[model samples]
Target chain A: AQSVTQPDIHITVSEGASLELRCNYSYGATPYLFWYVQSPGQGLQLLLKYFSGDTLVQGIKGFEAEFKRSQSSFNLRKPSVHWSDAAEYFCAVGHFNKFYFGSGTKLNVKP
Target chain B: DTAVSQTPKYLVTQMGNDKSIKCEQNLGHDTMYWYKQDSKKFLKIMFSYNNKELIINETVPNRFSPKSPDKAHLNLHINSLELGDSAVYFCASSQRTSGSIGEQFFGPGTRLTVL
Candidate 1:
């Protein structure tokens, strides 16, 4: 019933270029959405979350995401790509203390 | 200090062997959870406990058993390990109150390798 989809399996971008990772969710009610980044062989770190209020949410490591209720999408964006930003990104939807995660998108940055 | 900690960052064992992974959270949260991450990095929730009471249990193999000694400690024991059991296991905690399931804090994760 509730699910998350990250369409991009892999993305590559040159340094200083803009980056966008797409995500979409399927839920009955307003979803508690989150973005997490996982480095190679590391645990996931929370990037940001969208609960209520302003649609644009800022996160650590210079990442930001916007929640669009009409489209059921919460896409992550970055003004400039960094070499260190190359990692796996996941989008999750939480409800009643449970989370539904997407397949994840792997980002590759070329210097 | 680590907010959530798991013992044995890496484990390697043969098939049919029994092993256990211990997890502890010092964040004083009310809820704890265990998640399994496959080689493809797909995270699936295994079990969850709130104040030592089982609250959520996903469709996991019976070979996997979770025990909570107290509110802060949760241990996962697996019997008769198989190659398919080899994956990274993560323990996370969150403070859920008044129907608000807040953000989760995860441990470093334990990488298990079964031969």
Candidate 2:
């Protein structure tokens, strides 16, 4: 079956540190990839997406994700991490209108 | 403007109770979806309706039914809610059938707690 995998269950980074979250997918066909962030008591906010064209995609909140077809990965990165960046991040693969989300990684910020 | 909205941000009911979560999208999308976020925060597609036609019905139980009265609205009704059903229900909409891979917009979600 098609699926998305987020390797890190919990990631901790100090303020001002650089961050990278890994995401790998398995599907029969090329899928539309997306990264979403969720704050406490809020909805899922799209961080970035990779539909086609250039593999590197930029998104809001200073986030970016690179799509690597060979590796079947779309990892998210942020140059500088802020305290507010401490939230749960989800990687999803879209097939048609339906989506499959990963287990999610909870980022904790250390002061 | 809010693209997708869901009513009853929080719902708490007994295991045998029945409840409904309403979703509305102002994005004028032809496709609406219902998703379940489990305790592990794994979001899974429960149902998808495109132009009022059922496009995808996941392995979800029949106790949970999705109704799309129109393109902009899709509601989820759960019968005999169980403790396993105690998770966040999200409403999302996208332009799936428009021959484009438009990213889906999600609602704030309705967290249902079955006691």
Q: Best TM-score goes to which candidate?
A: 1
Per-candidate clashes, comma-separated: 0, 0
Q: Write the per-residue lDDT of candidate 2 for residues B8-101, one digit (tens) a residue.
A: 9999999999999999999988998999988888788899998999998999989999999999999999999899999999999998655655
Candidate 2, residue A104: how far the Cα is off, in Å: 0.7
Which residue pairs overlap in candidate 1's backbone? Answer: none
Candidates in order, TM-scores: namely 0.98, 0.96
| Residue A105 error, candidate 1, Å | 0.5
lDDT of 1 by residue, B1-115 (tens): 8899999899999999999999999999989999999999999999999999999899999999999999999999999999999999999999896786788888889999999
The superposed Cα distance between candidate 1 and the true structure at residue B37, in angstroms, equals 0.7
- Model 2: pairs clashing at backbone N, Cα or C within 3 Å: none
Which segments of model 2 are wrong by more than 4 Å? B97-100
Best by lDDT: 1
Sorted into a CAPRI-style docking class, model 1 comes out as: medium
Off by over 4 Å in 1: none
What value does DockQ give for candidate 1? 0.75
